[model samples]
Target: MHETVTVAHDDAAVVKMADLFDPEPATWGLRGDPYVWAALRKHLSGKDIPASLNEVLALLHAAFDELVGLDLVTEPASSVYREQYAHGGMSGGMIDLDAWRQRLIPLLTERARMRLEA
Candidate 1:
């Protein structure tokens, strides 16, 4: 049994939200994923967190879609090629969309919730 927590959308709250990725995730979907995450954090740092969790989710998803050039929710289990983020020898600039939706998004959401409780 869990109660819904209302997320704060103030400057401090949003700063904390964006800082969730400060240390970066332990694992990534592909070589360029870290670059995408870096870009994603920079992108999010400027915006205000929405009041509702759903809106927060939408905000994150939309940012990811914009930076990755594909919507993870509708896209199939495939990788998107990004020349701008290419650095590795193989699979450079290729990002795993499934990992973003399944791993990153949920991780951010959970971090948000934890922040609320703290």
Candidate 2:
């Protein structure tokens, strides 16, 4: 007998989403969290999609966490976010997520710069 496993995020799905966020119009690349790739991969999991769009969205929301760890979203002509903010970033309780952002930003920036040069 053989153990079974599954793969996810077939080439077409990544290629399509990558196209949406590609850094260049004529070239292919991706922006946003590397975890997006991870999340996409996990969600695909080579299993068939469920029967509902809501189900899919819920999965995405769960797999991926916040970007800046706060309501980083901005809207023009409006100073308020209509949606109540939730910590996609936090699992336990209230913590200074913004402070963590301040600490991580510089380190990630340096790493990205090094990658660009390499």
Per-prediction TM-score to the true structure, in the order listed: 0.81, 0.27
Q: Write the per-residue lDDT of candidate 1 for residues 23-74, one digit (tens) a residue.
A: 6789999998888988888888866555567877888889888887788889
lDDT tens digits by residue: candidate 2, 55-80? 43443334333522333222122111
- Most TM-score-accurate candidate: 1
Q: Which runs of model 1 end up more than 4 angstroms from their true locations?
A: 1-16
- Deviating ranges (above 4 Å) for candidate 2: 1-35, 66-118
Residue pairs whose backbone atoms clash in candidate 1: none
Return the TM-score for candidate 2, rounded to 2 decimals: 0.27
Model-by-model lDDT, in order?
0.79, 0.33
lDDT of 1: 0.79
